[model samples]
Target: MSWKTFPKVELHLHHEGAAPPAFIRGLAKEKSVNISGVFAEDGSYVFTDFVHFLSVYEAATQVLKTPEDYHRLTLAVLEQSAANGVVYSETFLSPDFCGNRDLSAWREFLHAIREAADQAERDMGITLRGIVTCVRHFGPDKAKQTARCAAETAGDWITGFGMGGDEGQGRQGDFAYAFDMAREAGLRLTTHAGEWGGPQSVHDALDDLRVERIGHGVRAIEDPALIERLVAENIVLEVCPGSNVALGLYPDVASHPIARLRDAGVKVTVSTDDPPFFHSTMTQEYEQLEQAFGWDEEDFAALNRSAIDAAFCTEDTRARIIKRLESQ
Candidate 1:
């Protein structure tokens, strides 16, 4: 009955966004940065809307000033994720945050993060892979630099490229050059879409960005044709039900589109988009799905299988995790 003990895989987590508020607060205090307004007395992030949440997310990252800081952060995040039974995860890592879009500077942070992840794999039962991500609102030009950073190290640790942030950005096509660069480097692609924009945005991401998976593509349910297209294409959706409720994208867990998307023959996987910010853990995500939709262990296992299939990791790694999942 304790979902916390169930093996799980996360595919759409954000690196800095997963930072514990206490972790950020500690870093802020060490540097004398006054960001107390970002958190409530309960030590939870506060934001009235999505745009404000984006600003708050960036403000919190200012505390992570060095690669060592990211090393510490990676350990902390992995510990929390492991405790919640996340056996494997692929997190979104923005080069913009690592080094402000500088390839040389980003390398240092990537090294630190990868080192920490390796250590965590040894210490905890969690395995992590990084996806070099571009912040969409930062514009297409900046995305090109992020793609460069991803392409430079697209082999093992950094296996994927993605875009996150404001979904209302110009258009997915505007970032074609960056996606092309990552594609040429053989990086698997994904993009944040349909969470904020309508189904048309999801369509643009498919036609233009040509992503294999989508982050928060729940809104695609709005267009039946789009839904059918998604089913036909067999694109996976990284659905974060808890995040949807927390961000007011849905009124409650029961109203989330995850079940509908699944029943419609769409491949879907669950993740905590920003765990701490939404006051959710992987255990809580599983519990809510069970409570809201009467899901059972088999349901969760199937979801994990879908995540493993859609994961931007090596076949060897995926097979290893699938073996562990079967043991559960």
Candidate 2:
């Protein structure tokens, strides 16, 4: 069977990062934002390295100046994801982008996004959930505010809290207060680790933040004890093979440690962390994994189940997703 024909689940996507280049270009035209260099002649985002990638990301975000922009982005992104055979996804949303750390504006953005999400579920049969994430590189004070917004807006759609940014910025412990606040509000937690940093970063994220999942945790392969602990604790790794390869984390797809980590008894799920930035989609991720590791239908199905199990959605939603996976 073609990998594109396999139904899948994505648990490590980012809201703004998923915006298509055409969409951002149209928005730029509307707002008269000077972001031409950010895209290529064929209308795709262009960046050389991780730091420049962040700049391009923020440049694309400049056009998303209102709640309605985000609402439209949510619908557009989901439509594309559904076309790529993704049946369930959880995307990271930043309060800093939604409202610049204002709770009221954040609520408005959340409402718009949730409304679009409900419509997407009805029209495309795709389940969408939000994980309120703090930009770790922005500073701990901002993260606390982001956590406060997430804590205040705890509901069916906003189900989780996370940290995403330059992992090398501040120590993981510096953000413990924010995670604690979100935990108090009963939000499931995760953090980006082991992507740009080494195994010690993963250790700090687990020991300090106490996350239930690790985003791009392929680096944990460096520490046998850490891999054993992840298996023992049953923590899920939202592995994004395409992102790792694009960012030089791995020299090539053949060298990726995803299959090895799974072989070591660690639970793993696949996702496209930033689809357009990495020139990847859900279908592409599955296809590359198949080509590199000879992943078959059963492997894809089990990966879907792992995503559903690690998802931060409500139990009822999870049950429905599991039922869909079984039917697939």
Best by lDDT: 1
lDDT for residue 163 in candidate 1, whole number 0-100: 94
- The ten-residue window of minimal lDDT in model 1 covers 34-43
What's the TM for model 1?
0.99
Clashes of 2: 0
Q: lDDT of all the models against the reference?
A: 0.94, 0.92
Candidates in order, TM-scores: namely 0.99, 0.99
Model 2 / residue 192 / CA error / Å: 0.4
- lDDT, candidate 2, at 268: 95
lDDT of 1 by residue, 237-306 (tens): 9999999899999999999989999999999999999999999999999999999999999999999999
Write down the RMSD of candidate 1 (Cα, Å). Answer: 0.7
